[model samples]
Target: MAARTVKRRHVSSRLSCKLFIVFTVSIFCVVVLVTAVRRNVPLDFLWGAFFQNGDVSNFSIYVHSTPGFVLDESTTRSHFFYGRQLTNSIQVLWGESSMIQAERLLLSAALEDPANQRFVLLSDSCVPLYNFSYVYNYIMVSPRSFVDSFLDAKEGRYNPRMSPKIPREKWRKGSQWVTLVRNHAEVIVDDEVIFSVFKRYCKRRPPIDIRKGKLNLKLQKQHNCIPDEHYVQTLLALHGLEGELERRTVTYTLWNQSATKTDNKGWHPITFSYANAGPRKIKEIKDISHVYYETEYRTEWCHSNSTSVPCFLFARKFSRGAAMRLLSDGVIDHFELSALLGNE
Candidate 1:
C-alpha cells in the first residue's frame, strides 16, 4: 500500500510541474503582446550616429504617424519609429477640432513619464538642424517656452465666436509646432473649460455651397479655428503667463510655399520631393533666419526683434524624400549638425 501511494504522489507532482511551466509561458507571451512596442528610435542610418554616444536616459521619442503607415525595415528605415508609435492617434483634419485632440493626446501621453522635462511636437517632415544633445540641453536650460503666438490683423485670425469665455483681446495666433515645460504642458492638457470653449466655437464654418464645394463667403470674413495655434497661447495670455512663455518656435517652417502643392497665395510651407528638392530650392529653406518677438501693435502680437536667436534647431514640411535630399545634397553637413552633435 505504501509503495503504491508513493508512486501516485510522484505522478501528481510531475503533472503539477508541467502545468506550472505552461502557465508561466502563457504569462510571458501575454506581457510581450500587451506591452507598448514602440521603440521611438530614429531611422538607423540617418539618426544612428546621433544616438551613438548620447545617453539614452536623457530623452524619449513618441511618434504619432498617420494610421496605416506600413513598416518595411529593408527600405523605409521604419525600425526607428517602431514601438514609438502612439496607438491613440486620431485622424487630424486641417483647421478642425480634431487637430487639438491629437496635440492633447500626445501631451497627455508624454506627461505620464516624469523624466520628460520639456515637450516639443514635430511632424514626420521635421529634421533636426543640430544634434540631439544640443536640442535637449538648449530646451532644458531655456527660461521661456517657444510658441509663435500673435494677433494678426489679417481677417482670418480672430472671430467673434470666442467672446465671453475667451475674450477677443485674449485670442492669439502662433505656430502650431510648440514646446512647453512640464507645468505649462500640464496646464494645457488639464484645462477642460478653456479647451472645451475653443472646441465649441473654434471651427471653420461649413461651406455655404456644399454641392458646389465653394468656401463660404461669410466664413472667409471671420477667423477659422486653428486651435493648435490659439488654445495654448490664449490660455497663457489670459493667465498672465510670461518668462515661461517666449512666444517663439525652434522648428523652422517655410510658411511661404509648399513644394508638393502650390498654395494660391504662397502661404503654406512647401513639401519636398525629388523634383523640387534641388540645391536652389533647398537654399531658400536654409535662409529662413527671420525671427519674431512680442510687439505693441494692435494687429501684430509678435514682431521681428534683435533678441531672437538665429539658432533653428529643426525645420519642417520636409517630405521623407526631402529628408533624403538633405542627406544627399550635403545640406545636413552645411547645417553643421554632424559637427555640433554630442559635443556637450
Candidate 2:
C-alpha cells in the first residue's frame, strides 16, 4: 500500500511539473510576440535571403534597421516571424559611438538563447556569398574569431587624449562586421570601463567652414575614435586574447578609390553599383583569388608583425542590384550553392 501510494505521488508530481513548465513557456511566448510587434525593422527580405538554400530553423536572423516599423501586420500571416524581432532597438549613427551601442544591443538579445553559438553581424547592405550549410559549418568549426583587428597608430586612429585611460599600446581598429563567440559577446555587454570613455570624450564630428561670404561644408572625416572598430578589437588584444584572433573578415569590401566625383572623402569602400555590372566588371570581381587592399593601407600581423590574411566567405558594400547581378551573372551559382547540403 505504501509503495503504490509513493509511486502514484511521484507520477502526479512529474505531471504537475511539466504542466508548470508548459504554462510558463506559453506565457513567455506571448510576451515575446507582444515585444516583436512594438519596435524594430522588418527584416522580411533578409529573412528570406538566409533561407534561400536551407530551412529557417538552421539560423536565427536579426536585423537592426533604422526607422523602426510595426511588425504586427506582417507577423500575422507567418508563424516563423513570431518572437524573432528584437526589442530595445537603438538608433545607429554613422561613425559614432551609437554604432557600437547598437551592436551591443544585438549581442545582448542574441545572447538570451544559449543555443546561438556563432553570431554574425551584417547590415542590410550585406549579403551572403556562400549558401547556408557552408557558412554554418565554416564558422562553427573555426576555433578563432573572424574580426579585422590591427594597430594603426600613425593614421590618427589612436587618440592621445585618451592616454592614461587607454594606453598607446592598447589602441586598435578593425571592421565592425564580425563573428563572435558567446564568451566574446558577454565581454562586450559586461564591459563598462573602456566603453564609458568612448561615450563621453572620443567623438567624430562634422567639418564646417563658414567664411565672410561663402558657406561651405568640408566633408566629415573619420571618427576621432571609431568605437565600434576600436573597442572590440582593443579589448580582445589587451586581454591577451591574441591567439584567438583570426584578423581577417569573411566579408570582402572593395578599397579602391572611385573615378567619378571626389568630395566628402572618407574611409568609405567603393560601393560596386548594379549599373557597373558588365562582362568586364564581372570578370574583375570574379577573380576573387586575389584579395583587394587600399594601396596606402595595410594591416600587418602584430604577432609576427609580418603576414596578412586573405578575404573569405562573403563580400560587402555591394549594392542590392550588384548582389542580384552576382546571383544572375552566375557568380553565386558558380560556387555551387547545393553542395552545402549533402545527400543526407
Candidate 3:
C-alpha cells in the first residue's frame, strides 16, 4: 500500500511539471504574435465597429505615437488604443530619415509577438475602409506583402552615391504605407546595411529657388530623396525580395493633380472633406481593381487567393469630420457586410 501511494505521487508530480512547461511556452507564443503601430491619428468612430464582430483576441495593437502622448478616454474613442504607445517613441519629421526610423521602431516593437503574421504601417491621416475581419482575412489569405514599388519618376531622386550598398539598378520609389508579412517585416527590422546607407545618403533636397538664387549651385544638382518613400521598397529590392511582395499599397491616396499643376513644390494627396466622404466615394475606391505604374509601365491587377479583388483596404488623409461622416453614414459597415456576403 505504501509503495503504490508513492508511485501515484511521483506520476502526478511529473504530469504537473510537463503542464507547466507547456503553459509557459504557450504564453510566450501569444506574446510573440501581437502586432505593432505608431499613431498620432485619432481613431475614426467607425473603426471601433470594425472589430466588433470579429475575434478581437486574434489581433493585437502596439502604438508608437508622439512621445509623451497618451491614448485614453480623453484622447481616443477606442479602448484598444489605450496603453498601446511605445515607451521609446521618437519625434518624427517629414521628408527626413527619421520617418523611416519611426517606422522601424514600430516594426521592431510589433515583431516581439511570435503570433504576428502581418505588420501594417499607417499615417495619421489614414482610415480603414472595411471592417477589421475583412481587412484581416484579406491580408491573411495572401502570402505577399503589399509594397507599392516602381521605377523612380521624378528626376534626381536617386543618389548614385548610395551605390553599391543601394545599387542604381535596385533604386525604387513607392508610397510609404505598406503591409508586410512577418519575414519581410523581419528583413526591415534586421536591416543595418541598407538603412544606414539611406540615413547617410537619402535626404529630401530643399525646394530650390533658382530665381532667388538663395540655394547654392551645388545644392541644385543634389538628388532630392524622400527616405520614407524609398526605404522599404528599396530595402526589399536590395534583399532581392521583390518577388515576395504584391507590389502595391493597400492604402489609397488621391494625388491632387490640380495642386501638382499649380504648385512647383511637388504633389501632395488631397485631404478628403466631410462633403466628399460619401458612400459614392467609398465605393469608387473599393471599385478600383488595378493600379497602373506609369514609370514601370506595369499594370497591377489586384488579387487575393487567386481571386480578383478590389485594390484598397484603407484610404487616407481624412479629416476628423470626414471620418465621423463616414461612420454616421454607415457606408463603410454596409460595404463591409456586402463584401462579406458576396464572399459567402
Top candidate by lDDT: 3
Point out the worst 10-residue segment of candidate 2 by lDDT: 1-10
Which residue runs does candidate 2 get wrong by more than 4 Å? Answer: 1-49, 71-83, 211-223, 256-264, 277-310, 330-344
- Whole-model lDDT per candidate: 0.52, 0.51, 0.65
Q: Order candidates by lDDT, high to low.
A: 3, 1, 2
- Candidate 3 — what's its lDDT? 0.65
Which digits, one per residue and each the tens of the lDDT, describe model 2 over residues 193-230?
77887787567655454452233333334345566667
Q: Between candidates 2 and 3, name the one with more favorable lDDT.
A: 3
What lDDT tens digits, residue by residue, belong to model 1 across residues 1-344?
Answer: 00000000001121111100000000000000011123232223334333343455555556444553323452234243335545666566666777676666666767776656567766545665555545555666564566766654443546676678788777777676676766777887887888888788787645455555445555555654566667777888877775457666666665542333222232456665667767786555445444433232322122122243344566656665666566666654533434423243
- Residue 40, candidate 1: how far off, in angstroms? 13
